[model samples]
Target: MTVTRPPDVSVVVAVHDTMPYLTACLRSLVDQTIGAGRFEVIAVDDGSTDGGGAELDRFAAEHPGLFTVVHQPHSGGPAVPSNRGLDLATGRYVFFLGADDLLAPHALERLVDAADHYGSDVVLGKMVGINGRYVRQDVYARTDPDLDLYGSALPYAMSNTKLFRRRLLDRYRLRFPVDMPVGSDQPFTIEACVRAERISVLADAVYYYAVRRHDRGNITYRSSPAQRLDTARRLIEFTAGLLPAGARRDAVLARHFDWELSKLVGKDFARFDPETRSAVCAAVKSLSAAYLTGRILDRLSPAQRYRLALAARGRIDLLIQPALHSGSAPLVLEKERVLVHLPGFDEMEREHFVFNGAFDSRMASGIRVLEAAWSSDRLVLWIRAPVLGDGAAEPAPLGISGVPAEVTTELAVDGSGTTLCARIPMRALLGGRRHDIRLAVTAAGELYEFPLPALGRRLRQRRWHRGRPYRISVIPGRDEQMVVRVSRVPWRRALLWRKQ
Candidate 1:
């Protein structure tokens, strides 16, 4: 394709041997809701052996004015290809798209509109996952005209698949790290977010990040933990150099601890080889001890906080216990304390541990459920509420929807607050079908709702017992008590089951 004039946006695609999915990805860009004259595609074929170069050539020939293909020797990573595409980009704004991913029809139009309207140096479009769970739409729940990378939730949207003003990149001379094989885009994205004068988020615009269900070719999915951790260390050092030591820096690093670093202390930790385990443990311990402060650690979930604490202490062996449980362990609440009962662990092990109780500021005034457990016949909830003055309070009647059920409530006063234990019949609530039972307490002619913690979904681990064939999940709901989803096992084998 002959380049005549600069376009509004340049779509930079770095392709390797992604022939199977490249056609759909290129097609999505060509069929953009934005007019053809407004955008151009600059695709770099990084030494494709599987005829992907030919595919790009065909596309270029078909749309000479809109598509341009650059052929380069394999650099073993996207960094070189992306850098080449950047050099050849002749657009006011640059948007990077993966060769295996597609964009929503109006992605470029919305991003350009938002960038122009807000005069933003960087504009982020929402990313939706296809055939995988990589998408975090919550990060882009609202549109921000001027987002602070450190202060706002924009740091969570730190993928290179965003629109950047061409002048900003040229001024900063920003390019991806060519040496790093994995997580190469992170440093580039981080630096861009830090240097940009104004960044806007267009939550309505979507970029479909495709994950191949079979034979995924992304380097990240195939890289070893040691390899990935090396890049992680580099990224951490790079990020530290950008920001001063304070809440902002801690917040940015906190994401790494919560998501990436936490994997070392997850269920798969025990499965690693001795060398891999030792290396991972050492790296995680060092990273956690250096950056994971109480201020930042307090913001994570109970499970995460516990794991990080163990990591910081360098108790890799002890970390394995909680990791093995996989969040199925029932939480026990006593007075002001929250305890996790690990399977096969001694009572001393269970009693010695205490999790962070300050989930949110609302827990100070209203009632909060610290832990919940389910049995064949009953559902037990451990709750903490404000203490009554005289130590004498009327029992509040608990309500269970979907079927007739018996509710029993017991209250005890302690040094911290009033502890309420409620037991409800599970059979009546479930009724052999999936049900979201809402529990409420009626006192003084008013209904008081109990807010439960939002434990994210997990289909990978079988939390429910074998032969039971019924799984119950607790999701945070708009109303009281939380929403409970019960589902029968669709097959004899689990969803994520593999042959041992």
Candidate 2:
């Protein structure tokens, strides 16, 4: 009798009617630098009517030992197919790959190596959106060999596309929830991250998540508002059930609140009909009443918190007014409350419509950087913001953080509301890494953060100190924000620049 050794990694692909894309996906698997002997491909063909099943069979026949093709009746959701593949995974590590997505040639090799090197039960290699698809980049800002799920931005990046240890899954019986037709990946990924002894994040781009230009039939695209709302509610309940009530739990729940809950009341929400709108508001109220802790609510932005608060209080009409008003609603300051003038809502209950909370009377809707320039090797930003307090205002302080450090400056008044002149020493950004700049102001005991628009010039500068060259550039970032990148100029590049 001959014994076959278990593969080091198993790539579980749940296939639907993804044909041409599936071919590319399988090819990527075949070309993996991890070698076919080290990793096996389990392609679960869930009744792929578009000849995808036949393609999978052909690939299995050609690849033989490297591929395993399983056919099952059409499952309405990917969860069933995913669970089927997980049940048959026989490897030290298991990675879930989307049927329509492509992996880099060295993806599995790097993921497996990182997992082994760090003893990580879950290893997330950086993934990017391809073909106009949007993937959140917050968690991929940098690599952390051992990431803290609750302390970091991992909560927002919970997708089941990464590598998971087989033993850990077996130990906890972790599997996708079959009932969740959409968004089931989040629950499975979140639970695995919670139970894993160590979770790692690699900065290398290893996966390409594509949004087929011709086919937007994926569950996420096909899912209705009601379906999304239900899934969000279930996710909130599930996350709340997993961790105890505390800051850690709040951190995880905050993602759901911001992405899921707040999304329910976003711009397109106003387009929903009366019945659908009512249903969404009711669901929001239920979830908020059940799991929205004060800490979690505080974690939300002022706009998000206000929209959700209106929804929770069954003021759908009031919630819809913001969209109708185009945010041109009048702001009335009564004592310490700055309220957006909306009809049918009591001004006294300022908690529901106010920008922040009680005793808060300001908004950053008008805040912007009037000028950004280098003043003697120091980056200076002149910002105009809303004026709140009187001459005795003290105006609070303004700050921006990126490399574990914050540069703060006092807000000054100059005939135009309030202004801030922040002088950031170039030396503070000397490290050879990208720094994500975030700006926030503390006024009236409430903190309001705003995005700095692209300064348009691609502000680039370089300085030579002690014979070593350093370069710094501030440019537009995702979502109209700005980022600062600093690096040490290589000798070759410096010489090239000198010649230029």
Candidate 3:
């Protein structure tokens, strides 16, 4: 049965706390080289702060018929609001313009024309990440055989940077799931890719995707292996449910299973205590059978398939597990250990020390270092450590670390999950400040030096260093919308003034 297409084009702009990007995004939509009346922009306010709700009304007032504003509290992801936009859209084609991304002048015209020209349900065009003059690839280029995406399946990459037919969505009953912490674009695009009867890829880069490096919200399971595995398990179930009925699908499912298993057995637990490893391994054993039999595994690679094949055959091997082997101590030059907790997960990661090449180059690949600070209410972290033989370096010697004004030092456990507390009398004795304490940690057998910037200021003498901890920053609250990663950061020392 052939599905009929709609008459006009509908653009869904889901904004939450993204007031800053809204005006630009909306302007881009209405400024389409094709003119305003040709398409309708349905802007949904997903419970945004920073006056996003009111801004929607302002735009609607100015644009009138060309705009439709749907207001709802911030749902988990843009999926729900996008789905809401889908329900109200009357266009033959629909595209989600991420608030942070912009549309090329002809973005609408190109995709719209492509949909009609190829008689395709999906119209994919090239896109470049355009943050300032910095241009990055769109990830949808149809250049490599390895990146081939044909028919209803998407290329291995999923950036909602394409123009899709509204009819195709109706035909497949496709909608985004608001529940997934992240990678929601994965299932939504995959479903469309798998079911798309006709697809087109244009060579032109009409969409500009802005890559916000500071935004960490979309990366829920990035640092936590356990969380990623759990999310993968749920998504695996969803993908499996959409699979074709047969053993071919089982092979595809197996490949994905290997990945989740790797996260489970391979990452977090590769070096866990014996009891912890056994508990997790037991859990995987229980889920492996059903997971392998699921659908959507038809397109997996041989190596990926082999990994799963091994696990499926009760051959959970050591190679698939993630392990960390910290070798011998370095030349005992310098050491600085501070307890820090990044906002999201409940783990206190310690930045043991910053290494300087002052030691041995061989130490670079062996240790990992994290620079942590509280930027606004968000705890931001920048981590870089060397992979063995990865040319790791000791941290550039601390020019200095600056912290906030010296307040009365209090010692207590931050009940938060980062399991950290300065030993009681440890923090108390250091009264009003003024001390030349040089801390050092030998990471990779090198001696490096670090001076506390806040400590320097506490003395009221003077700040000698050129750099301070102010170097670290969070995204300043993401302009109040557009899931740019949110967290509850309390007001505390701007520096402890340990401006390092």
Candidate 4:
């Protein structure tokens, strides 16, 4: 028995600088088959200095009964504004839409129909990203969603693509972590999914997720250690606070932790510090206890259970996140050489970016097709001239800056093209937190900055210059000992002398 009334839904589309996309998103949403009486659109302008606030007000004025606008300064993350939505929401269900994305014509209707048919507490849909791009997601449509949270939410993950019963959020006090620059959605969605007694699936792909070549200044783009850990910390605390009163409570809570680690930590480990990293590892290690009483812990195979156990410990047991075959280049397939190229990239002049993993994909074929690790005798990076332009540039050696020692070396490149090479005495990185690696360059009369965090954290963003000099760190192979001190990674000797 689905909730048969013309159920009320609060469609919360949070907006920022993307007024253009926000306009289209709102248009498509209100234009949906579900009319104004069925759902209320709440556009929260999260301190958008770029006219998003005015645009929302204009839209609300035009669509009187269908729209409401909330204006506030940027809360730094999605959770705070989302909580604002919860408080103002007068609907029984909630739908989240990103400012720069849109919903399908029948998205709300299909989700509401599914919810009624199954009397489900939550409805999961799919988000297809990068318009006119060669990729698609039919995640929710293929699943037997009646299977429950662990089963459906496992692969069909993503909060923006789903709709939820308001009580599932209220009962568990589910809210986003405003502290995080990215990944605040994990805990909120996970809590709602697991705690909800029934969930429905609308196999229809109802959302458009636009993936871009370069996303600088995007909220998810400004990832940091404290933000990620804070999200995880809150999610765990949320679980502990809402544990049901019964024998199965421990079991469900344990599985919740397991799922959290499996999803959040793996995506964010290289971006965090050793202390927070250790906490995450411990959280992952203890997740198995959730299975005995969780949504579907008992149903998993022994292999799956062991893998979850390994994941919680923050161990990259290949079973959890497998080893990826590294070394790839676009357009050219040389044994070790790479001709790195991004179409229309050269249009912008002057950049100082080192190859850090982009798009955070575990697969090697992801964006830019480049990943690197340096633990061997020497490290080599080959760069080729796509089309030698007005003034040809060569990348200097990977230099160690921000540390006390003068440990900088030039890399070897064949005279024909630029091949960056670095060789160093092992003394530089002995105690972990002593140094920072920077790829320095001079073009158009200025020195750009790219500072590495300490050893333990991996950097995301394969391409960092948002139209300027770009620098980012390794994303996957994180060294667990060092840390970022005052935005610099200084050696322990320098630290020791300073303390004395």
Q: Please report the candidate that would top TM-score against the real structure.
A: 2
Taken over the whole model, the C-alpha lDDT of each candidate is: 0.70, 0.79, 0.50, 0.52
Prediction-by-prediction clash tally: 0, 0, 45, 12
Full-model lDDT, candidate 3: 0.50
Alpha-carbon RMSD, candidate 4: 21.7
| Winner by lDDT | 2
On lDDT, the stronger of 2 and 4 is: 2
User: Tens digits of per-residue lDDT for model 3 on 305-347?
Assistant: 3333433444434423332112222222223321111111122
- Model 4 TM-score is 0.50
Can you tell me which runs of candidate 4 are displaced by over 4 Å? 1-7, 131-138, 141-145, 153-160, 167-174, 177-181, 205-217, 233-500
TM-score of each: 0.68, 0.70, 0.52, 0.50
Residue-level lDDT tens digits of model 4 in 1-500 = 68645337888877778766678878887788988789988878889987889988988888887888999888876777777877788788888877777788888888777777777887776566663432334444574557454333343354544788887788877777666556677667766766778876655464445543244545654555555545555555555565564544444454444544444444455445567666656655553443334444444433334344444544543322322111232221122222222222243222211123331221112211122344442222222211111222433322334443333322223222223333322333332433444433222333433432233345322221222222223332234322222123335433454466
Q: Indicate the worst ten consecutive residues by lDDT in candidate 2.
A: 387-396
Candidate 3: stretches off by over 4 Å: 1-7, 130-139, 143-155, 213-227, 245-288, 291-500
Error of 1 at 245 (Å): 0.3
